[model samples]
Target: MAKDGRGAPVGRRVMLGVLGLGVLGAATGSYVQNSYDNLLAQISSRDPTGVTGLLPGGGGFRFYSVSESIPHRSDQDYKLTVDGLVDRPGSYSLADLHAMPSTRLVRDVQCVTGWRVPHYAWTGVKLSDLLDKAGVQPGAKALRFTCFDGVYTESLTLDQARRPDMLAAYRMDDKPVTAAHGGPVRLYAAPMYFYKSAKWLSGITVTDHVEPGYWEHYGYDVDAWVGKSNGRDDDPTS
Candidate 1:
């Protein structure tokens, strides 16, 4: 198995495939990344055939239950609230997010299930910027992210939440996010599996200890690093 940039061991199957293709004169790193991203686009553009089809490249990404999906709302009526352990607890509209300094990144999207989509482009605000604006208190040790779907929720340790790659994403594929793809806003945790990037994100509550998210309580690892925690032995996206 080859180690990813973060030194996590990649699955032997993935490493073998990649190495075999290298013998065919294919450039390994960037080329594989671009191919994976293209595959994700193709998968997302079509109706899902099943769990396998809903994810990129057949069935490598992890899938979690929503418990329930919330009703979709238009951008005009959408609101995101930042509350909990902060000096400034306030609400932000879609316009508010658009008005902030925006960032764009193209990085690998890995899942615990074994699939990966590399070089996927995401555009949004740095999560740290929002935390800074909200004035996170010294006591804040975790961030709970609640989705509009009501059933989906996630939490990150303070250090993880502040990572430069984390984003409150508004756009994907160079366009505004569609409802099927997590919509008007979503949490993008670049170093973790796609599940950590909760869809239809709505609320952010800063707290003092780690809170196991919906999936975490149901056998998923709370600190879900791509290869390190899930028992799947995949490569780290970072």
Candidate 2:
């Protein structure tokens, strides 16, 4: 959810309706549901149409866009860059990222607003591998993530970024990430709130200190550990 610029539907009221609708749709006819979902998926850009988000959701993911009508990036045009406070800066195409060592994890995704998707399969390259290859320089304290969606941003301490669970994810449910899912690449912040896992991920920059993300500007916790911050007391996500 963009505190302002983020187009995602982070508002609790909107998300409540979204979650409610999907469950309601499940009781309807299968053919009717699938047809509606297919039509919406084809037309969706950053997310399936806002209306479709109310009809049926796949994999328990709640759907909403960062903003209005964000043009989806094609697989051939996607690139992810790693730079800032590093000895070696690099830009990687989707193919280049895919060629690197990959890791797969099945982790539950928890949204700060109170919804959870359990045992979701995510596959990607570890951010630690990229940090090591980039030769993190002395005094670097954190990593900031920027998204192609043009509004949402996220951050982690260097120590947090180096956690084995952090990833630059490219696949989900054993399928190549689709635009509706924030694809060809996105940040998979396994142990944090789902919002910390920025969608349409494009840049990773090492920095001297942690930078507040978009949502942070509007009072959401900067350190969004699931069930830990923001008045939520629940299970540890990891």
On a 0 to 1 TM-score scale, where does candidate 2 land against the true structure? 0.75
TM-score of each: 0.74, 0.75
Per-residue error for 168 in candidate 2, Å, reads: 0.3
Residues 29-107, candidate 2: write the lDDT tens digits: 5567557545655555346445545544432587656755554888899989999999999998999888999999998
In every candidate, how many clashes are there?
Answer: 2, 6
| Candidate 2: stretches off by over 4 Å | 1-59
Off by over 4 Å in 1: 1-70
lDDT by residue for model 1 (114-200), tens: 567667889999889999999999888999999898788899998998998899999987899877778799899988878899988
For each candidate, C-alpha RMSD in Å? 12.5, 13.1
In terms of lDDT, the poorest run of 10 residues in model 2 is 50-59
